[model samples]
Target: MVQEIDKLTDNVNDIKSLFRTLNETLESIEKRLSRLEKMDSIEHRVEVNQIDLSDIKESLQRIEETHSNEIQHINRRLDSHLVKIAKIEEEMIIIKSR
Candidate 1:
């Protein structure tokens, strides 16, 4: 009878050890899953940020093009005025000689 009791006790201890190992494994899996979830959230935010930056870059490029066009227009107007002034100066000199 004593031998039978010893065998049962050993079986119970083995079962307890198995239960402890299983619990530890479950806890480790939960921790890994939480880390993966956080990584996914971070990746999504990065993608969103990249999209926003692209939009901003496109807007800035458009503004730069508009400013360049305006500058060209002003330069053309200044050139026209300079030509008129030169013509007027030549006419004044011709009249003085006559």
Candidate 2:
């Protein structure tokens, strides 16, 4: 009877050790899952920021294009006005001589 009791006690101790190992493994898995969740959140925020930056770049490019076009138009108008003034001055000189 004593031998049987010793065997039972050994089996109980083995079961307890197995339980402890399983609990440790579960805790490790939980920590890893938490870390993954945090990484995912950070990645999502980075993606959103990237999209916002891209939109800002596109808006700046459009503004630059508009300003360039406006400058070219203004330069053309100035050139046209200068040419008209020169022609008017020549006409005045001829009239004054007569």
Local distance difference test scores for all models? 0.99, 0.99
Q: Give residue 3's lDDT in candidate 1 (0 to 100).
A: 100
Q: TM-score for every candidate vs. truth?
A: 0.69, 0.69
Compared to the true structure, candidate 2 yields what TM-score?
0.69
Runs off by more than 4 Å, candidate 2: 1-12
Lowest-sum lDDT 10-residue window in model 2: 63-72
- Judged by lDDT against the true structure, how good is candidate 2? 0.99
lDDT of 1 by residue, 1-98 (tens): 99999999999999999999999999999999999999999999999999999999999999999999999999999999999999999999999999
